[model samples]
Target chain A: MEEIKEQTGHMPRIGEPAPAFEAVTTHGTLKLEDFKGSWLILFSHPADFTPVCTTEFIAFTEIHPKLQKRGVELLGLSVDSVSSHIAWVRNVEEKMGVKIPFPIIADLNKEVSLAYGMIHPGQSKTETVRCVFIIDPNQKIRTILYYPLTTGRNMDEILRIIDALQTTDKHGVATPANWRPGDEVVVPPPNTQEMAEERLKQGYKCVDWYLCKKKL
Target chain B: MACISPDGKPTESGTKMLRALQAGLKSPEEIAKETGLPLFRVRSGLRELTQAGLADQKEDKYKLSEKGTKLIK
Candidate 1:
């Protein structure tokens, strides 16, 4: 485990500021600060023109508008060149009938990839594994998800997590497992006995003192 | 058969216009009337289709290119 940890490098922690960098992408130069005041979905795929990555790109394309409606911007990354990125994007549009409307970073130097701990040498020394970083508007890392190369990601789950995170950020509450939009949210428990007693009469559905759920 | 735009994704109106063109609507007015879309929208959709190499215009008449025909299929 320690060896694996050393190989993976430093993993960014939740609530800590996300590692920042400027990179050359298919859409030209982009800086982390450019995404200030908007939620950013910074993700890494293994490579371009690969089967799994292509499918994931199409899925991401399908959800682009939905993410935009929620004020989320997606930025893809791979250890590929800008020319390769453009050709792959064009090929995807021509063959799959889906436009990848997001910018894909060309991290040939592995600078940005290393900063985000995306290049797990144990997985593959030359390629990045599937990794996702959900950064909030305040630039804090809110969530992280890692997937093996064989398994494709669930776009709906990503969206659900974003909704859950945003809800918790806005309302000071938590969500149960498999929580979807419009569901009742869980409120944090009261700190004192008097507050616990007050919480019971606060019109929430209190299953117990520490477990209270309410519609927001 | 690529649908090209700034995003390279076809818009609803663009798809409608392409369908109307494939169905033998020759002019923008004909496409607009057939699809119940505005003339301006039809014109822009035609422009997008043409720019995407899916359609061709000849003497103010619109026809689907081989690529456009394959796309509708």
Candidate 2:
């Protein structure tokens, strides 16, 4: 397919290195390495001055503090020029009563969008669709989220997911359904018969012998 | 335990959503038609995907989250 042909480069994958980027941001020229030693949430919107994008941008800006406390940095991108990003950021601050302290890439060339697979043909040809990538401090891709044009994302869910991912990575466990920070985690099923027998003796909450539960 | 298909497809509802997504039915109506799931189920299933941040909802369409995209691929 022509679409497939257009995406020939080796795209970034979870557990793989996130492609490095150096571009002019709202403040000045910035590089991906500048965010070293912290988690990065790289997301994209279609364009500026749009209603839906504005609401999402405002929400992300508001949640930046919470994201920062957990060692996450926020970077937003769109196919808009530097001037456009500045204007929109100013407007968002003035009209929405929030400041976007993060660097928004002025990706007019569509380089970052393409590398991140943010552009989808069905969504819009010229503008990037909603895409969110959670890149870890080691520069490995941790998680990715793609959204349609109509619905808005829940910021709390994003926060919770990062919390879950951080905890899962730390403890080698899986968070259960409706998992919140400080809640019990779902223990991984014992992989062997011997281990299964010993696991039940631990007195973890279990729906069955192999299904153990413990708080994170 | 739900087993993945020999062809690497996910379990029943997972496979249904995958098939629908591949067919470009990221909307409720399209998913129902392709998977024979009720509209409510399709919506709720998609909601589950979104709630866990596995799906992104924007404007009026649905698409797999970047993480969901990788999982399906």
Candidate 3:
């Protein structure tokens, strides 16, 4: 355990493999490797029954089907017990009329939170700040988002980023600022002069030598 | 269909715009401001949302159709 702490003290970086873990959640026991073939959105909330977290939970539930259609899975975590998680899920369903379909980790020991670097001491010593890690099918961390305790997360942005990442991976291209699906994508800038010249006449909308956009 | 685009695919901006509309953001500019999406993307997303029958535009503002409200509920 000491060795694990030392290794995971630093936050995981994008493009690095997500740290593996096994934990008991509201659904059942799950391992990080269990989601190997699907993209995963591992998010952490400060606590259950909180107003901001509850709203975020509803938003996540609303968008869960869309995420599943794109081969993505959602997992939630907080430094709470399994009983607390179960009760909160029940309460959310009863009051909000939306079922939280994903498993939420009961990180009572803070093991998984530590592994994912979810807890920031400066933010709050007892609870975790809002943290989101977008892991691809290969278990590589693609994007990270952090929100303060007072704010709620934007589920649309989360879904949008998943689309952007998948689009980039599938097309070998980058997306411009605020890019959406069915929109023109950015072509990788050429490294050499010859490549730059060749790119201009490739039937793309080229604004300059290095910048180009083409319909996917 | 609430979040999916008319082309039969899911789009991030489309979802953002839909959520913004559900939150009472009426115009493309307001949607863009609320969601922090680019103006051009917001316009395209609005177009896609309209084509998908989830939203309707008045003189200059947009509102969720009954189908869209049902989807959110």
Give the per-residue lDDT of model 1 (tens digit) for A72-178: 98999999999999999999999988888888999999888888889888679878899999999889999999998888889999999889998998899999888
Name the candidate that leads on lDDT: 1
Q: Which candidate number maximizes TM-score? A: 1
Please state the CAPRI-style docking class of candidate 3: incorrect
lDDT minimum window of 10 residues, candidate 3 chain A: A1-10
Q: Tell me the tens digit of each residue's lDDT in model 2 across B1-73.
A: 1113335445577557755675442666677678875343455456556655556776656777777677877
lDDT by residue (tens digit), candidate 3, A1-216: 655445335588899999999777775556787677679999999999899999999999999989978989899999999889989999999998988888899988888888788877767777888999999999999999989998899988999999999999999999999888988999999999999999988988999988899999
What's the lDDT for candidate 2?
0.77
lDDT digits (tens) for residues B1-73 of candidate 3: 2236457644665666777888663887788679875343455456656777888988878998887777656
For model 2, residues A1-216, the per-residue Cα lDDT tens digits are 866647432356788789988766664455676566578899988898899988998899889889867978888899899889989989888987878777788898887888888888776778887888998888889998889877777899899989999998899999888999989998989989898988888889988876789965
How do all the candidates rank in terms of DockQ, highest first? 1, 3, 2
Runs in model 3 deviating more than 4 A are A1-8, B1-73
The TM-score ranking, best first, is 1, 3, 2
Listed models, DockQ each: 0.02, 0.01, 0.01
Q: A119 in model 1: Cα distance from truth in Å?
A: 1.2
User: Candidate 1 chain B — worst ten consecutive residues by lDDT sum?
Assistant: B1-10
